[model samples]
Target chain A: MPTINVQMFEGRTLEQKRAFVKAITEAACTTLGSSPESVDVIITDVKKDNWATGGVLWTDKK
Target chain B: MPTINVQMFEGRTLEQKRAFVKAITEAACTTLGSSPESVDVIITDVKKDNWATGGVLWTDKK
Candidate 1:
């Protein structure tokens, strides 16, 4: 079983998440030889203020 | 660098999250030889409806 956690900005619709998870499941199955049903995708809706890159928060970026 | 994703039920306070991340970062430093700054701890607050075990959704469990 393979568990994947995706961190992205919030505001995605349920339909968008459904499609995203479907694509991830397929990719994991094809590349890792894992069963589609056995793959778990957990999406973390991160706020810009909470995520930092290169020592700078995304909210502070231009 | 080590990135740890923790999946737990929601409703934790800010202090709890702070302690959790601190503990995880320390553990990674001890076992994986990763620096505290390089160990990223991402906590995913999963809803019962979105989590499942043994083919049964957590929301549907007793």
Candidate 2:
């Protein structure tokens, strides 16, 4: 099974999640020849304060 | 930097996360020789409906 974990800012609707998982699964199947039934996508909604890039937290941006 | 992503069912406390990250970072440093500051751990809390095993979603189980 191919398990994919995606970390992104929170606030996406359920409709978006449904579309996202469907698209991601299809892409993986087409590109890697993986079966749809074996693909698992886990999406994480990270807080702005919890995420940092270039050693700077997103929440700290002014 | 080594980024490790973990996928598990939701409902863990913040204290658990603090301990988890600390242990995982240490483990990576000891085994892979990666610095703690360079290691990033992202945790994904999955719902039963979003996770499946043996072609059956966990939520669908009765």
Candidate 3:
């Protein structure tokens, strides 16, 4: 089983999550020869303040 | 950047998370030769129903 973990900014809708998992499972099946049932997509919703880029937190970035 | 993603059961305290990240960062530095600042630990708290093994969800397991 291939477990895909994603960390992204919060505020995505349930429908978006549904679409995302479906798309990712399809992509894995096409590229890695994995079955949809064998794919697991775990999504972590991260606050902007928690993520940093180039030493600056996303909340502080313009 | 070494981004370490962890999926575990939910209900962890904030202090636990702090200690866990610190320990993981130190481990990465020791084993992977990665700098503490360059190591990112992202934890995804999973519900029992959301996780499965051996074709059985944790919620259904004995």
Candidate 4:
């Protein structure tokens, strides 16, 4: 039930995404003690303008 | 890839989730014109205490 969603800055290659999914899935299995099959990792490449933190948009703040 | 993430109040059945995924997938395909296979929807059921909006936690604010 440990469905991990990683929202990160865009411009990553397909290979980089595959690596991140693999690593996060392994970490979930180890830390959360869940089966690899049960874990679903979804990567959402968000544009800087679409994300915000601490009440400031990433693009504007960055 | 218009991956949809629906974050709502938890305690829904598996059937409900399946329905949500199916509905959202179709919507993505229709609106975004993306392939169903390319659409990956991940549901993250966060605790009420874990989420915040307008600088106030959901649980505490609610």
Candidate 5:
């Protein structure tokens, strides 16, 4: 089983999540020769304060 | 960078999270010889309805 975890900024709608998982499953199957049932996509909605880049938190970024 | 992602049931306190990340970072450094600064730990709090195993959702399990 191939489990793909995505950590993104919070605020995506339910419809977006559904479409994202569907597209990701298809792409994984096409590229890796995996079955749709064997793929798992777990989405994590991260807050700006919880994420950082270049040693600076997203919340503090300009 | 070695980014460790942990998916677990929600409801942990902020103190618990701090302890967890510290411990995990130390473990990675000890086991993988990676620097503590280079280790990133991302924790995802999962809800029962969103996670499933063996074709069964956790919320629906008895």
Candidate 6:
């Protein structure tokens, strides 16, 4: 079983978010062939300042 | 809003998992004090082989 949780900045349109989720889930399903139900996908949208990678806040990264 | 995604190998009981979630959520709530609805916590249980770190499968690591 494989589950993917995506955390990103909160600005994308609903369609954009849906497409992203669909693509990711399909990739995981096809690559892993995990049960659909077993694959849990959650998207958490946060303020740009809430996330950091490589010691730099995402808001400041760009 | 702070959401924590926890991915781990499967085996823990419901109670154990609930306790873990509760502890994590409470800590996050206290530290971040985000709205309960905004604080989403998702747990993904995977087979040992499905997860890897540092190019090593979790099943083989332990």
Arrange candidates by lDDT, descending: 2, 5, 3, 1, 4, 6
Over the stretch A1-62, how does candidate 6's per-residue lDDT look in tens digits? Answer: 44556565677677665655555445444434445566665767878788776888878976
Candidate 1: docking tier: incorrect
> Each model: TM-score of chain B?
0.85, 0.89, 0.88, 0.75, 0.88, 0.76
Candidates ranked by DockQ: 2, 1, 5, 3, 6, 4
The ten-residue window of minimal lDDT in model 5 chain B covers: B49-58
Instruction: Write down the C-alpha DockQ for each prediction.
Output: 0.12, 0.16, 0.10, 0.04, 0.10, 0.05
Q: lDDT of all predictions, in order shown?
A: 0.75, 0.79, 0.78, 0.69, 0.79, 0.60
Model 3 chain A worst lDDT run, 10 consecutive residues: A13-22
TM for every model, in the order presented, reads: 0.55, 0.57, 0.56, 0.47, 0.55, 0.47
Error of 3 at A33 (Å): 0.9
Model 1 agreement with the true structure over A1-62: per-residue lDDT tens digits: 78776778977766566667767777777888887668776667789999998999999999
What ranges in model 1 sit over 4 Å off? Answer: B1-6, B9-44, B48-62
Best by TM-score: 2
Specify the poorest-scoring 10-residue window by lDDT in model 1 chain B.
B49-58
Separate clash counts for every candidate:
0, 0, 0, 0, 0, 0
Return the interface RMSD of the candidates, in order shown, one decimal each.
Answer: 4.6, 3.9, 5.4, 13.2, 4.5, 10.8
Superposition TM-score, candidate 4 onto the true structure: 0.47
Off-target runs (Cα >4 Å) in candidate 3 are B1-6, B9-44, B47-62
RMSD in angstroms, all models? 6.3, 6.3, 6.8, 16.3, 6.4, 15.1
lDDT of model 1, residue B30: 95
Model 1 Cα RMSD, 1 decimal: 6.3
Q: Which ten residues in a row are the worst by lDDT in model 2 chain B?
A: B49-58
Clashing pairs in 5: none
